[model samples]
Target: MTGASPLRPDEAALREAIVHTAREMERLGINQGTSGNVSARCADGLLITPSGVPATALHEDAIVWLPLDVAADAPVLSERKPSSEWRMHRDILRARPELNAVVHTHSVAATAMAIHSRDIPAHHYMVAVAGGNSIRCAPYATFGSQALSDYAVAALQERYACLLAHHGVIAASATLSRALWIANEVEVLAKQYLLASQLGTPPLLSDDEMAEVLEKFRNYGMRGTSGNGAH
Candidate 1:
């Protein structure tokens, strides 16, 4: 608890969700220590987990409040320093209005694939969950730079998830849970792809096949939405 005083009830709840999402990432083994970050849109900005702080030790007020237009040197404005990847989170949240939550993780399998600069092909139907036939791997960049954020935005084209080369995985969605779910699913796909590679290249589904699956997802996949299923 620090500067800028208190949070409204809903904002407080969102902070709690951010913390819970971060903790869940570790428990699911998709993240470790302070290796990942989580955030959700609020008011005119986003509430992101602070830098180098373990999720289990996070408290609501310790979350960093980054205005969408926060200046580069204004990290001091927030009570705590935002995550080192704050640039990526800020860029994604600002660029994708439909996505309210963003989660970045160094999940083992996903990062392993990223290190190889391998994109996950549509070898599985669930690959369409990311809104494409494949999950892309962004080119490598310094961890906390605008260059990394630029690469991430490009790689996430038409998709909710992407792999950061030599770094980790990142996913953004309309909700905290959905973003985390997408990250987890990305890791699963990465693991499957790696295992299958050992037995020779996996047969990829055709474009038409993925198209049909995407259409079905648009119709009945979501409880009450369009093309918004978990897949």
Candidate 2:
């Protein structure tokens, strides 16, 4: 069911955060117009950005509350419709309880790489922060379709970020800011990868080395709160 109730104090704050994040994405230049969406987990559902709304026009009340258990294609009851990618956000939050926020972007570089269906390997050690040595690209599926949501869930199985083939990027984390950070980082990585390709194949970190980095990230904290290794 789409939750249309008045927001509780905490829910209100969460809704505001989602609106802020949706705008932040635009300011960061990782998203444009209304091509991306942001959401934060709330009481039995998620507060997602409204469909087709530009960031400048977004507001707390415009956020749509979608229950985690509702069917992906179920008719929404809210005054505003949730983003078309709401199912992807909902499924990820349901499958990864540790993650509370999800950011989906059509960032240029990342989408360029996604259009080619490429994975971002551990060419830089920082890739470990995403919980793996590589950010996989989920095979393409039509936007708003269940198949796309299924593909996203599978690609994010052991990673917090993934590229949707021919589409864009998905970055999810324990907090909205952290998820946004990952989204930006993925775009940076994609840009760097494309630039480095000019010098032939870029040297990649070995699996053993990536494993060590992953361990270190785990110990130092994958979340940005620690401020140790996280960006």
Candidate 3:
């Protein structure tokens, strides 16, 4: 038989962070009622937002905890169902062991950019927040499906964030709060790019310049700071 999984004291902390950040996202207009979900890795499993539940109403106990090793047929942790996109969270955690948190949201600017025919360029230094050189958008796929998960994983290659075509954005990080911070920064950048593009052609940083910025990100004080800059 498989060994019993260990418990995680950090699970409660993660749950609270998810709820709090989800509300923040809503307040900032990054997410709407019941439209976004956040997940974080726990020692034994995962903590995730419940489906069809608004961020404004989330409670700690209301969050769902799914055992990582549980049989697919086994009962889930809460009476409230887990997010339909749990599969995406599962795949990301399985593929990127270093990532502790995953956030998916339908923020306006990011989603608008995702619908464009091209990738979101790293024209600015802040692009490093999402990892690698640029933010990529995965091809459109039905939400909550394996196809979507596969596309997201593929787009996330060597990157911490990706835009879901016709859908939203996904960002992962080493901590729950950091993940949320990156997601927020991505939206802000998207908004800037949109406005800049309308004002005329936006100057884009060259590949070498972006590389330098990414290198700097490794030592940047903001790299892992969280909770509205509380650090």
Q: Which candidate number would show the highest TM-score if scored against the true structure?
A: 2
**In model 3, where do residues sit more than 4 Å from their true spots?**
1-7, 69-74, 77-80, 221-231
Clashes of each: 0, 0, 0
What shift in Å separates residue 92 of candidate 2 from its native position after superposition? 0.6
State model 3's lDDT: 0.80
Q: What TM-score would candidate 1 get against the native? A: 0.92
lDDT of 3 by residue, 85-152 (tens): 88888888888888888999999999998887356787677787777668999999998888999999
Better of 2 and 3 by TM-score: 2
Write down the TM-score of every candidate: 0.92, 0.94, 0.89
The whole-model lDDT of each prediction reads: 0.85, 0.87, 0.80
Candidate 2 lDDT, tens digit per residue, 33-146?
989899888888888888899999988888888888767447774445889888898899999998899999999999999999999988888877677999999999999888
TM-score of 2: 0.94
At residue 211, give the lDDT of candidate 1.
88
Query: Model 1 lDDT vs. the true structure?
Result: 0.85
Supply candidate 2's per-residue lDDT for 167: 96
